[model samples]
Target chain A: MKLLEDRIKKDGQVLPGDVLKVDNFLNHQVDPDLMFAMGEEFARLFQDEKITKVLTVESSGIAPAILTGLQLHVPVVFARKHKSLTLVNDLYTSTVYSYTKKVSNEISISKRFLDADDRVLIIDDFLANGQAVMGLIDICEQAQAKIEGVGIVIEKTFQRGHELIAEHGIRLESLAKIAALEDGKVVFEKQNN
Target chain B: MKLLEDRIKKDGQVLPGDVLKVDNFLNHQVDPDLMFAMGEEFARLFQDEKITKVLTVESSGIAPAILTGLQLHVPVVFARKHKSLTLVNDLYTSTVYSYTKKVSNEISISKRFLDADDRVLIIDDFLANGQAVMGLIDICEQAQAKIEGVGIVIEKTFQRGHELIAEHGIRLESLAKIAALEDGKVVFEKQNN
Candidate 1:
């Protein structure tokens, strides 16, 4: 977690409208070595939980999800944004409003992948207003799967995402939580440990 | 490679209209152990090349790309399908036509991630008509980066993807090359190893 916070401090760009650009190492361009380290951290945090599947949204979350799955030796299921031709008719669908893209899109996972017997861990790159994470939680709820925990790479603590997940009584762990971004500087939340 | 080929044979579904769906392990739901094996195989295949980065399209390709990056100890840059507020203005963009979706979309990589000095290895889930690969190739061309090779999980030998990539004079390595998927059965091409 310290390594991730350091990386974000060194390379992250803070822009207007609460935008933190980590393309150099997190989202668009990924640092695999650091990603694997983060995966190990997630595995350590959720070692007690019975996580059967790692669920995430497409594009940004896939890297961290893959790394976490590798560390846990579990399977990862990414919800596709666009409906492909091969997607089965039976699916758990949820609508997510993207504040970045300014569009509402439907996210879905095939019913064959999730069921009541599964314990799921949801992972994502950024947790802003918690819309995307809520959508993933919605899908899991529909499938009757047990929510083990949620792992995030970078979280905006000033936003309502952390509170929303906590309101559901789910354990949420984030590597780097940004308290504020003032004058192109990232202010991280002080670690209690 | 044998493991990958075996997975394809067992879990891969050959639908009507030349569509082979391996979502069970490759795309929608990813098996991290198998993904790690494929990454090791890719590292072996491109051992001679000095790969500075791993490039791929988003959604389906990010898992393998991240695993391959871990093996190579390099950064993985995934081209995003849509532009978001976090993305910078400077980018390398290419248009790709999806045969399955029956539409064309733009894939773009941030200019900050790729440079002329970087040697990239492109990774993907499947290579059918080579449209997505071609799009990545175009981005590499625009950035003036060196493309060491293209690593594909499954290559449909009956399709023209291999021929197109071959024509480009880039080294193409596919773990499993299917000669045909006729009558819902996968026929693999014998490797020349």
Candidate 2:
């Protein structure tokens, strides 16, 4: 976690609209060693949960989620934002609004992947408005899957994401918690949970 | 590679439009164990390449790419299909046509990710017309990166994907090569490359 926090402060860029760009090492251009460390930390934290599946959204979340799945020795089921050619029907679907993209997308997971027997741990690159994680949770609920908390690489503490996830009574863990991104600097929250 | 082929034969579905749906284990619902197996196989195949980076497109390719990066002790950079909020304009961009999606999408990588110093090995979930891989190669070309080779999970041999990639003089390795999908059964080519 310290490694992630330090790397974020050193390389993260702040844009208008509260955008903290960690693309240099995080989402777009992934550092696999760093990603493995993050995943190991997440797996260590949630080792007792007996996580059956690691769930995430498409695109950005795939890297960390895959590593986590590898660490946890579980299958990963990424909710597709669009109707992929191979994805079948009878899916657990949820609509999520993307704060960055400014467009709502339908996130769906196959019914065959997640079911009542699944204990799902949701993982993602960043948690800001909590919309994406919430959508994943909604799909799990629809499938009667047990929730096994959420793991995030970076958390924007200034946003309402943490509070929203807290309301669901799900345990949330973020590697790096950013207090703010001001003056092109990343401020970390003193206490990370 | 045999593990991948075995799994594909058992779980992969043959859909219309030359679609081979291995979503059960390959793309949507990823088997990390199997994915790691594929990565190890890829690492074994390209061991002498001294790959500096493993590259792929987002959404599905991250799983294998991450595992391959882990095995190779390298970084993984995924080209974004959409312009993400944090991605900058100093990018190597290329347009790709998706035969399955019936839409054209622009794939891009930040110039910071790929460079002439990198020996990139492009990995993907499927290979059909090779447009996606070619687009990635184009982006790498723009970056002046040295391409090590291309690794694919499944290749529809009935399509021209192999021919197009061969024209680039880049080595191609596909885990499973499908000869045809007739009568709702999947047929694989006699030889794999």
Candidate 3:
């Protein structure tokens, strides 16, 4: 977590309207070593939950989720933003509104991949307003799957995402929690440990 | 490679119109152990290239590309299919037509991540018609980066993708070379080695 926090401090760009650009090591461009380390940390945090599957949205979340899957020895399922030809039917779909993109995307996962007997761990790159995480949680509920916990690479603690997941009674862990972005700088939350 | 081929034969579904649905392992729901093995194989194949970066498109390609980056100890950059708010300018963009999706996507990579001094290895989940791979190659050319080779998880040898890369004079290595889909079965090309 310290590694991520440090890297964020060094490279994370704070833009207007609460935009933190981490494309250098996350989002667009990725650091596989950092992803692996984060995955190991997530595995360590949720090792006791008996997670059967790691679920995430497409594009950004795939990298970290797959690495977490590698560490936990579980299958990684990514919900597609676009409805491809092969993925037309038998899907659990949810609509998520993105404040940054200013659009609502219909995220879907094939029903065959998730089921009632599975324990799911949701992972994502960032949790801003919690719409995306809530969408994944919606899919999990549709499949009647047990929600184990949520792991986030970077979280904005000033946002409502934290409280939303907490409202669902699901344990949430973030590698780097940004307390606030003040005067073009990132303020991290105090670590409990 | 044998492990991948075996898994493909077991779990890969050959749909209508030469479509091989590998969502069970390689696409939608991913098996991270197999991905790590494929990544290791790719790393071994391009070990001498001194790869500074691994490039691929978003979503499906992220899993293997990140794993490959992990093995090679380099950063992985995934071209975004959809332009987000933060990634609007200073990009190396190319248009790629997806036969499966029947759409042309303008994929772009931030100019900040790639440079002329970088040695890049392009990795992707599937090489069907080679449009996606060609798009990445175009971006690499724009960046003036040295492309060491291309690594594919599954290559339809019967398609034009292999020949297209060959025509570009780029070395390509596919973990599974699919020969044909006959009578709802996946027939892999005979391995030379």
**Candidate with maximal TM-score:** 3
Instruction: Give the alpha carbon lDDT tens digit for every residue of A1-193 in model 2.
Output: 8899889878888898789988878888788889889989999999999999999999889888988998999999999896334444788888899888788888999898999999989999999999999999999999999998999999998889899889989999998888888887788889723
Interface RMSD for each of the candidates: 0.7, 1.0, 0.5
Highest DockQ: which candidate? Answer: 3
lDDT of 1 by residue, B137-170 (tens): 9999999999999999999899999999999999
Instruction: Count residue pairs with overlapping backbones in model 3.
Output: 0
Please list the residue runs of candidate 1 whose C-alpha ends up more than 4 Å from where it truly belongs after superposition.
A83-88, B83-89
- Measure candidate 3: CA RMSD: 1.8
Assess every candidate by TM-score: 0.96, 0.94, 0.97
Which has the better lDDT: candidate 2, or candidate 3? 3
lDDT of 2 by residue, B1-193 (tens): 5777788778888787667788878889888888888989999999999999999998788889888988999988998886333454787888898877688888888888889999999999889899999999999898999999999988888899899989989999988888899978888888623
List clashing residue pairs in candidate 2: none
Off by over 4 Å in 3: A83-89, B83-89
DockQ, candidate 1, vs. native dimer: 0.89
Model with the higher lDDT, candidate 1 or 3? 3
For every candidate, C-alpha RMSD to the true structure in Å: 2.1, 2.6, 1.8
* Clashing pairs for predicted structure model 1, backbone only: none
Tens-digit per-residue lDDT, A58-149, candidate 3 = 98999999999999999999998853344557989988998886888889999999999999999999998999999999999999999999
Each model's total of backbone clashes: 0, 0, 0
The sequence of per-residue lDDT tens digits that candidate 1 reaches over residues A104-146 is 8889999999999999999999998999999999999999999
Worst 10 residues of 3 chain B by lDDT: B80-89
